[model samples]
Target chain A: MKYFLYGGCSLEAGGKNYMVSLEPVCKALGMEFEEIEDWNCCGASISYAGANELSIMTLNARNIAIAESTGGYDIVAPCSSCYIQLVKTNHELKEDAELRNKINVILKEGNLNFKGSLNVRHLMDVLYNDGGIDKIKSTAVRPLKGLKVAGYVGCQTVRPYGEYDSVERPKVHDLLLKAIGADPVPFPKKMQCCGSGIFLTELDRCLGLVKEILDDAIANGAQLISTVCPMCALNLEMYQDKVNAKFGTNFNMPVVYLTQLMAVAFGMDLKKEAALDYCVIPPEGIIKAAIGG
Target chain B: MAGNYDPSFAKEVFDNVDSGEEIKMCMQCGICAGSCPLRHEMDYPPRQIFTLIRAGRRDEVMNSKAIKLCTSCYRCKVRCPRGIPVIDVMHGLAHYGIKKGIIPRKGTAAFGGEFWKMIYNIGRIDEKTLPLKYNLLEGLVPGIKSTIEMAPMGIQMFLHHRMKLLPERKIKGIKELRKMLDKAKEMGKGGAN
Candidate 1:
C-alpha cells in the first residue's frame, strides 16, 4: 500500500528522526511512504487560534489539496497538531459548504482546491488501523516485553472534535503498546495537555501542568512515557529538571517519540533509533531492557 | 474558606461564553465525575458544575469546592463522551473567582497564586523557594526527615548542571505581561459585577 508521509513543521525544521524512522517502519511492513512534495506548515496552533474561518482551516485545507493532488488517498501526519488540524478541516469542509466556499476562495490565490477527497490519519491511526497490530507484532525483531509505558496522547491528537478517537478516553496508544509487546499502564492523565506551545511564556503553568500529568503517570506505575508529538516529547523530556525542582518531586519519566519506541521494539539498533540525543531523560537503559542486550 | 457568595456571577460567565459542547448533551453516565480524582471530595462534581453553570448559578458555582479542587488534569475533559470542554469552562470559572478574590485558596490553586506572585515580582522562579511555597500553600510542611531525604537528589541535580542557581535570562516584556494580567483582572471583575 502507498501512503503519503506528511510531517508538518516539526519534520521541516530538521527534527527528521521521527519521519526517518517512520519511513523504514512503513517500508518494512510492506507499505510505501511517498513523501509529499513541497509541503509547507499546516498553520498549526496559531492559524487556528487567529481565524477559525479562513486562516487556519484554509491553510490546512491546502495541504489536503496537495495530498489529493498526489492522488494518495491516505495522508499520514506524524505531528499531532497537524494531524488534528488536517482531520478537523477535512471533517468541517465535508459537512459545511459555506466553510468550503470561504476556504476555497482563500486557496484560490495558490490555485489549490480542497474537496476533502483524501483521508487524514495520524501515524498512530495508520499503524494501528491500516497496518494492523498483528503486522507490527510479526515485524518485531525485539519485543518490548516487561516495559511499562505511559501512552501520552497529548492534546490535539485526541481532543476537541474526536476526529481520530475519543479525546478523554483514547485507546490508540494502548493498542500500539500491546502491539509492541509492552504493557500500557492505565493513567488518568493520558490525554492531558503537555503545555506544548504555551511553554515559552507560561513556564510555571506549563511545569505545573506537566508535573501533574507525569506525577499521575508515575503514580500509576509507568516507567516511560511515549508521545506522538515532537513538541510533547521536547516539553516532557527537556523540562524534567525544572518540573522536578518546582514540584519537589522525583519524576524520572523518560519521554520518547512513539516511532522511537517502535524502532526499539522492531529490534533496531539503539544508536540508529536515535535514543541518545533526547533533551529530557536518557533512554539508553530502557532501550537495553527492551532489546535484552 | 468562608467568602461572600454571589450566585449570578457564575451564571453570567457561563451565559456569556460559547458553551462549546451543549451541557444538556451530557448523558450523566458519570464517566467524567467518576474519573476525576477530586470528585469524591467535591460537593459538586464536574457534571453538577456543568448543570449549575448552564443554570446560571454564577455565585454558588464560583464558591463551590469543585472549582477549588480541580487539578486541571484534563481527566474530565478526556473522559466525557459528550466531548464537553470541562477543563476550559472550569478554569474560566476558577480564573473569574480567583481574580475577584472570591474563592478561598486550596491545593494547587493556592500554590499557583503564590507561584505567579513570585514570578511577576522577581521576573523569575527560584527553585529553592518552590518547596516552601508548595508546602505552605498546600498547608503541610515536609518534616525534617523528608527534607533530609530529598537533599541528595537536589544536590545531584545542581551538581549535574541541570538546576540553575539563577534564571538563564530575566524575563523580557514585563510591561506586556503586566498589561495582560491587568486585562485578565479587569475581565474577572467585570464578570463578577
Candidate 2:
C-alpha cells in the first residue's frame, strides 16, 4: 500500500527521528511513502486560534490540494496535530459546501484545485488497521520480548473523527505491541489530554497534568511510553527534567515513537534506527535489555 | 464586574461561534470545567464562561485569558453532556477577542504572530528563526539574554538535528501561496470570504 507522508513542522525539527525511523520500517512492511510536495505547517492550535475559521479551513485545504496533486488519497501524518488538522479539514470541506467553495476560490488564485478526494490518516491507522497486525508480525525478525510499554495516543488523533478506532479508549496501539511480543501495559489515562500547548501559557497546570500521566505510567510498571504525536512525545520526554525539578520526583521514563519500537521488533540494527539517543532520557540500558546488544 | 455584562453577548456567541448556539444547553454541571486539564489556569472555565455569556458579561468573557489559553484538547467537547463543541467556542472567542483589539496573552500572541508570519511567507516554519524572532520581539537585551539562557537547549537541539542553524528555504510555489494568504487577510475582518 502507498501513503502520502505529511511530516508537519515538528518532523523537520523536534521529530526528525520520527521521519528518519518511519521510512525504513514502512518499506520493510511493503508500504510506500510519497511525501506531499511543498506541504506547509498544519496551523497548530496557537496559529489557528489567531485566525478565523474560514482562514484556518482554507490553509488546511491548501495542504489537501498538495496531497491530491500527488494523485493519492491516503495521506499519512505522524504528528497527531497535523493528522487532526488535515483530516478535520478533509471532513469539513467534504461536508460544507460554503467551505468547499471558499477554499476552491482561494485555490483558484494559486492555480491549484481541491476536490476533497484525499483521505487523511495517522501513521498508526495505516500500520495496524490498513496494513494489518499480521503484516507487522510477518516482518518481525526480533520481537520486543522484555519491553513494557504504555501507548499514549493523546486527544487530537481520536477526537471528532477517528475513522478506524475508538476515541475514548483505543485498543489498536496496544494490540500492535502485543503482536510485536511486548507487554502492553494497562493504562487508564492513555487517551487523556496532556495539556497540549498549555505548557507555553500555564506552566503549573501543564506540569500537574503531565505529572498525572507519567505517574500513571510509572504506577503501571511501564519502562517507557510509546507515542503517536510529536507534541505528546516531547511533553513526555523533554518535560521530565522540569517536572522532576518542580515536584522532586524520581521518574525517568523514555518516550519513543511506536515505529521506533516496530523497527526494533523487525530486527532493524540499532545503528540504522537508534531512537534512545534522540530521546531526552537515554533509554540505552532499557533498550539493551529489551533487544540485547 | 457587575452591570458590565452586555445582554447581547449571549446572542453574539450564538450567532458567531460554531455550535455557540448550543451554549444554552449547558446546565452548569461543571463537566466541561472539570474535564479541562488547565481549568486551574482559566479565569472562567467553560461552564462559567457560558453563564457569564448568558449574563452578558462582555468584558469578562472577552478579556479573560481563558479564551486565549485554551489548548484545544477537545476533552470537554467529547464529554460534554450537552455535546457542546467547547474547543471551537474557545477558539472563536480567541479570534473574536483579537478582532476586538484585545491582546489576550502577549507571549502566546507573539508566538502566534511569528508562527503565522513564517507559515504565510515560506510555507514552512524555521525552528531556529521562530524562537529567535519570538524572544527578540521584546528587544535586543532581553532577546540576547533569553537566547543565552536557552543556549543549552538550543545546542542540544542542534546536536539532535532538530534546529538547523541555516534558515529553511521557501517552497517552490511560495509566491502563489502568499497571494492566497494576503487575500485572506483582506477578508479576515469582514469574514465574508
Q: Pick the candidate with the highest TM-score.
A: 2
**lDDT per residue, candidate 2, A104-215, as tens digits?**
8877878888887878888888888776889888887788886899988798877666586887788988998888888989898898777676565466677787899999
Clashes (candidate 1): 8
User: Which pairs in model 1 have colliding backbones?
Assistant: A168-B78, A168-B79, A237-A280, B6-B59, B7-B59, B10-B58, B11-B56, B11-B58
Question: What is candidate 1's lDDT per residue for A221-263, written digit by digit as tens?
Answer: 8888888886676678767777878888877778777777787
**In order, how many clashes per candidate?**
8, 2
Which segments of model 1 are wrong by more than 4 Å? Answer: A13-15, A47-52, A161-164, A274-280, B1-193
Best model per DockQ: 2
True contacts kept of each: 0.01, 0.53
User: TM-score of the A chain in candidate 1?
Assistant: 0.92
Supply candidate 1's per-residue lDDT for B16: 40
> Could you list the iRMS of every candidate?
11.7, 2.1
Candidate 2 residue lDDT tens string, B105-180: 8777777777888887888878777778988998999999978866776777677665656679888878888788
Cα deviation in Å at residue A45, candidate 2? 1.6
Best by lDDT: 2
